[model samples]
Target: MRAPYASDPATARGRRVPEDESSFRSCFQRDRDRIIHASAFRRLKHKTQVFVEHEGDYYRTRLTHSIEVAQVARTISGALHLNAELTEAVALAHDLGHPPFGHTGEDALEKMMAPYGGFDHNAQAIKIVTSLERHYAGFDGLNLTWETLEGIAKHNGPVTGDLPHALADYNALHDLELDTHASAEAQVAALSDDIAYNNHDLHDGLRAGLFSEDEIAALPMVGPAYAEVDRVHPGLDSYRRRHEALRRVFGVMVSDVIETSRALLDDAGATSVADIRHVGRPVIRFSDPVWAELREIRQFLFTRMYRAPSVMKIRAEVTEVVEELFVLFLGRPDLLPKHWARAVSAAGGDKLLLARMVSDYIAGMTDRFALQEHARLIGDG
Candidate 1:
């Protein structure tokens, strides 16, 4: 049974291009299926999360990270009596807009496109679903339901101020109520992303030898988790011990969100999805104490893992790849793929339009593909 404030597919704001109802699936379920089958979604396998895609097989790529986020989203949504399908859809589609080399690539692209509209993964995601994907016979994009689009547009919270050009363009056609908070499902998806990354980055960092198990054990939530694991299972194998402790840490974060959000939801007294959106604050979040601890953990990761010397070196290398590629393509639109060439030709010497076309083409390249293209075209293999 769904809560009063949970999104119901039967009452969903319908798709932009209306279609016959599915015989078996709800509107949200259809939305989830479309997202899972999207070409952009499949490309996530070779997109970076933190480490570049070619770094290691075991490290989480964007694909695996999205899957983990979806799992956590479903768990939390179910616990809170929200729509799991919508939450899972939002989670699965959240990072579909990320460029080739994770943040490194995005940073480079944003710098290059500054004179244009600037690049934003979140807004690119909206562009991808609403206009970029061209598989449907009846529509240019997926024609996802309004609720799904709204969730994708503002899942992290309300989007205000100057919107990304992609989002701004779409919102002008169909308003996503960018100034209001998203449904409870989207809020759950956003937090699930937080949970998945916090836990997995530790595992990945340890695996990469950037940090040791003993080092993270000194952190706030992690220390208690390690102590409990040691008390219950002394002399455990190193691998098993690491896994057990991290899982416990994951549990603490998940449980905190659930318990704290429940309290917030009850206090808000939002008996409808509209009320939840207009509640003037996020109803889903960690408690103040837990958030403080998480912040400390994030700071440790920033120093010991994200901005570590080894990682920074790789970031520089990949940032150069993205920058060089952006410059090369911006100068020579004739080199773009045939389909993309047609789009560039349609730009008719408009630099901003040409740059956005280049951005879309380059942004879609996998990390390996970007490297190969750089080697092939730039003679830098």
Candidate 2:
């Protein structure tokens, strides 16, 4: 008989993953459904991947960003003969833990949560998927398929630390050899995140009139990337061209992922996407030369797009606003809505004490909800 789960060329493009005959679901489709039903996933509608609330009609929020990442991942998966379902799953749920107001909010929360567990969005993503999201499985959460969970666990595990306080510290994540040999499908999602944000941040900045296309085009890899788009769609010339330009960037990134994964799979004679990791080669991410170019692009975003005076002004205001809210809740117990005050007071611990209370309050917030609470306390709501 043919090897189990073997690819059939006929079902190649739009194949659903084989579930039991009674309940047909592909691996990626399962991921997508579980994510859609998860509380954290729904909250992404309000979280900031980049721009703040109500900034622009076209600027991407976290939900839109996740959808776009899925698109990029699926494109690569289709071309490379990898499982599209797995790619879509990875793309949809990647940013479930990001907070509002973007990095400024993340930093503010990190400072407060540091004594308990310094906040990192990647770590938080895993936490949300594994422990936090509730379901009736008596299993704590959605119990996503093992394959998807493994990728989420490794997606951005520390370059150094794998020491979850409860786990035996003996096994560092990098050394503990989990199957990080993600399908080209999964790898493309991670790379797609880089492509999506880098291009879109440029678009957002350009839209805000913070920078010009020519100026962004002068930056390292963006110069070539945007130029390729200009050439690809010669007739589209509105500032809206950024949208089409971004489409080309995704095309380039996906093409490379497909090419890299195919070469690795072909050389190893692997029977499936899961098996090609003969020696853990890096695939789907940028190759060495392009990686360095990406680093320069990241650096440019950090120095200019991120640090531009207008951006900094908004960041500062957001920081001050969140800080005041943090202080109010932690200092005067009565200021919190009665439930939180009772919840924190009943716990009676010094460790994460106030910060956990703060985290609970903040995590429960929608963008508008948080601001209204802030305004209410400040007498501005």
Best by the TM-score measure: 1
Give residue 320's error in model 1 in angstroms. Answer: 0.8
lDDT of 1 by residue, 46-98 (tens): 99788988889999999999999999999999999999999999999999888
**Per-model CA lDDT versus the true structure:** 0.93, 0.63
Q: How close is candidate 2 to the true structure, as a TM-score?
A: 0.79
lDDT of 1 at 42: 97
lDDT of 1 at 369: 96
Runs of candidate 1 exceeding 4 Å displacement: none
Q: How many residue-pair clashes does candidate 1 contain?
A: 0
Pairing residues by index, what is the TM-score of model 1? Answer: 0.99
Q: How many clashes in each structure?
A: 0, 2
Worst 10 residues of 2 by lDDT: 165-174
Note the residue pairs that clash in candidate 2: 17-26, 28-85
Give candidate 1's error at residue 376 in angstroms. Answer: 0.6
